[model samples]
Target: MRQINGQNSTSTIKQYSSTLLLMGSMLCSTHLLATTTATAYNANNYNAIQQTMLAEFALAYADTATALHNYTVLAIKSNSTTVKQRALNVALEQHDFKAALDIATHWVVQEPSDVPALFYLAHIALQAHEYELAAESIDKILSHDPSADLEKILAGIAPESKEDQTVLVDALQNSQAKDNPSILVIIAALEAQTGQFEQALATINRALKKRPNASNFILMKANLLSALGDEEQTRKWYSKASRQHKSNLEIRLAEVKYLIKVNDSMLALEKLEKILQKWPKAEEALFIAGLTSIDLKQYERAERYLVELRNSSQYQNDAYYYLALNAERKGHYETAKAYYRLVDGSLYAVSRQNLINIYTEQQRLNDALRFLTQERVNYPQHASFLYQAQAEILKKMGNKRAAIGLLEEAIQHLSDDPELIYAEVLLLDPFVQRDRLDQLLTLLLDLEPNHPAYLNAYAYTLALQNRRLDEARDYAERALEMAPDQASIMDTLGFVAYLQNDFSTAAKVLEQAYLLNDSVSIGVRYARALYMQGDLGRFAQILKQLQQKHPNDPQLAPLNSLLIPPPMPKSS
Candidate 1:
């Protein structure tokens, strides 16, 4: 309700604007040209005048760009302080910083005592990168209120780069407010961002001496020590802070947060439990506890904490989302679906995704497709994703023919989205339609030559066919270079070497791949390489372990053929 001029936000601007309109209507009835011409006019004339004023107010909400222009015109024509402030608000809302600065400067000139005007002037100056002007405005505010806290204002000056941070620090240090502890802390935080950790520690320690019991300084010092890699000293300071600030919930919560960051969930949960013992219904503590429980795989405890959060209106939607996850983790499909349906707002999209995943896992393909169809209607721009989701469900159901047909139809509509095209290539049968498979792989490689998936798939396919060993080796090598830690790509390189009769190299690469992934396919390949290299004992050991681990996997038949000699004694 604050006036656009320098008034506090809680002021009754709506009431004042209404009174002004009523007075304007009354004056229009007697002295205005249009109404005065109608001598016998009644409420109709006053209603027309009221409608005119209402229309102007409605314009402010209808279209921001047009409203800004109209407000600027009104301010110029009437020279009213209120109208100028309205223009300023519109300019700020539109992110037209130059216009906002001009309006705010005019407001200050007209109403010199307006503190909000000066603050906004500084804010706009900072955004425009007019550092000197920003400093001048900040100094005016500090001079106006000697005890003003510039922390919140300075916090807005986020520098995205080292040079930007240095510029901001220099600008702020030159200001009269530089002597404030809050300003010193802001500068120290910026210094830390620029990797001047030693300078940051010195500045923060200086501030702590000035205000020894300030929790913020203590926390900052702890963070600086952590950044400097002094773990022991950091823990000491954190413990000291919690002991000194026993009544401060934020200080206690900060310690728990640091513990969680360092992956010390046991200690974090212990501190959280102690905090909850005192304030059982604290929303933030309950939320973090719910997340920690989920991370620790305590589904029941997570559900309990998240359900308690449902009582707080602010976290109702978030609580429902977490509750859905808890039920999903417990394999309570119906319960999770019910919880997901109750979720709304920004969580709606993510909850819908979870529901799709749950339906797919449960093999309720129709339900998943139904939800995706509705989602496609709701978000038409995401049609490509919805199509791919349907195809994925078909693929999971072992209906590759239907999945391929769906992708073909989708490509006709969407026309060569690289992701969809790549997906279609994955469904290609290399044995039945080698030509078509090669064609699609070639197009995919052309689309994204450096794509690790494309490179690995092409290399693995060629290795399988044994037609282009050198090309396959090159592609697999490129894929390994691109994703050095990818187990599948490493297996591809091993398989290519095996096809080229490099059994020793194949054994080494497959061994690495097996260690990286422990996949049955990689283990079988490693076993085969060892068998071919005459390491019969090691091959037998690996094959036995694979049989025990996989228990009659059909994919292990080739390795089994190599291991078992087909009843040679029975012929004798």
Candidate 2:
């Protein structure tokens, strides 16, 4: 059974579980016996029971089991169309595929002309692996609307096993829907999914034979060829299809995507421009054009296409995010901020981070603090992180005391929140607040000894102060085990090895860290290990590379002076 968590609302249930639904076969069999024998003859009683059950469901006071039971009784006893539909909905909501199929079959029998009922029956049958029955139901639906697109509906027949899928394909092939072009498309797609490329190509060729000029069929054939690793043939077929039908928007879009995949962005942009010129209202084309412009670093052109998408409801927020990114790239911070505020959904988190970063970059520390204060009030759930962000700005401004004070205040509200605790521990310098740093680290490690961040921070601190070399190595190793790919943690291990005079191990570990992330600190340590190992040539070369990137870097100056060679003899 598919369990939908916590949502008892009817609309929410309907939205999420709209396709390929089935009640458990065992539950349906049990209910079928009761539905046949004990039918409620009176209409008034059934109405009253349905009303009571609906009220309970609406109030969120009834469990799914109770709702299903009540609706099942109504479906079997009552002749009302509304009552039977409710039962079908309830069975789908409970993810009982068999029950849903049983109710839906009854629904279609009662209302033979109902398109939705026929489609629901087909969807349930497909899910239950009754492929012939599903084909029959789908045929009935297509009889009502011969031109209806069954591609999306047929796409839902996803079986767990390759054997089940093959059975479904065979059943669909032998059934009444064998004559349907859309059904053939789905069959071809299934064959492709199972890696039967030749079989899929044969199926689509059959489809094209029926309608030689069908652009969708041609596009499907091109896609199959592409999947079979024949890129040249795919492009050739796409070109042939485009000549056959010049104005198919889907074909044009597919061709544009192919161009982009081949790294011919300029040509893709040209095709997109033509598509936009012909179909000015195509929001999808406009959105892609904007992103393509961004990829090509044509920020001004990106703004033009993205701004056009701003009027479209589906793409507006995403367009805003891109527009903001383009403006930021152009160094228009104020415009970028405005555009970021207009962005929403998952991108909102990214926009919020960007706002803080932009404020910091512009040296507007006071403004950032003020914004963080307001954000704390408005977004209380995220207030803990806001405190850390604010403290970081204060620390960067050389106000360590103020930063520590701010974290202490945040802790009173967030008490023992792991991130806040971690941030506070980092701020406590051992030389100045040795007792406090030790206390916090001990407490944090006691709470979550396996936490990679806490372990790395603790280990790096011990290594930095050059005390307890064995303990530091242990902590660093533990952290590396937890997050082996983390470059900073790898640096901690190398730094500890250096303190213990394990120059060989230090050089190896620090070299790995440098490869992962060529940061200045890691580079300096790596160079030092090389110099100690008498690999003076590589050491000088590494320092030279770091100096080029981080010129006037104080860390590099000390390391550079250490590698000075003996003065050459004047007599020579």
Q: Which candidate comes out best when scored by lDDT?
A: 2
Model 2 lDDT tens row, 1-572 = 12222122223324322121122222333455456556535445535454544634542664767767666665665555455665766687667778877877887787788776676777778767787888888778768876655655655456668998888888888777687777787788788879898999999898888777776778789888888889889878877776667788888888889878978899899889988999988999999999999999999999999999887889999999999999999999999988986776667667767887899899898998898888787777767767988899899889989999999899888776878888999888767787777777877898899999899988998887889889989999999999999999999999999989999999999999999999999999999999888888889899999999899889998897787777988995
Reference-based lDDT, residue 110, model 1:
67
Query: How many clashing residue pairs, candidate 1?
Result: 0
1-572: candidate 1 lDDT, tens digit per residue: 12233222212112235356446545655565464455566665455445435545665467655656655555444334445555666666577777767776776776676677776677677666677787788778767775455545545456576776778789879888886676688789889878899999998887787777777788889889999999878777887888888778888898889889889887888888888998888899999999899999999988888999876789989999999998988889899998987777778767877888888788798888777777778776767777788888888888989889988887888765767777887888778879878987888888899989899999998988888999999999999999999999999999999988899999999989998898898998999889889999989898888889998799778777775567756565
Evaluate model 2: give its lDDT: 0.79
Model 1 segments beyond 4 Å from truth? 1-98, 159-168, 206-218, 297-299, 311-390, 404-572
* Residue 471 in model 2: lDDT: 95
Candidate 1 structure, TM-score to reference: 0.58
Stretch of 10 with least lDDT, candidate 1: 6-15
Candidate lDDT values, in order: 0.78, 0.79
Where model 2 places Cα greater than 4 Å from the true spot, the runs are: 1-62, 80-82, 142-146, 154-157, 211-219, 240-247, 333-338, 341-344, 355-367, 370-386, 407-572
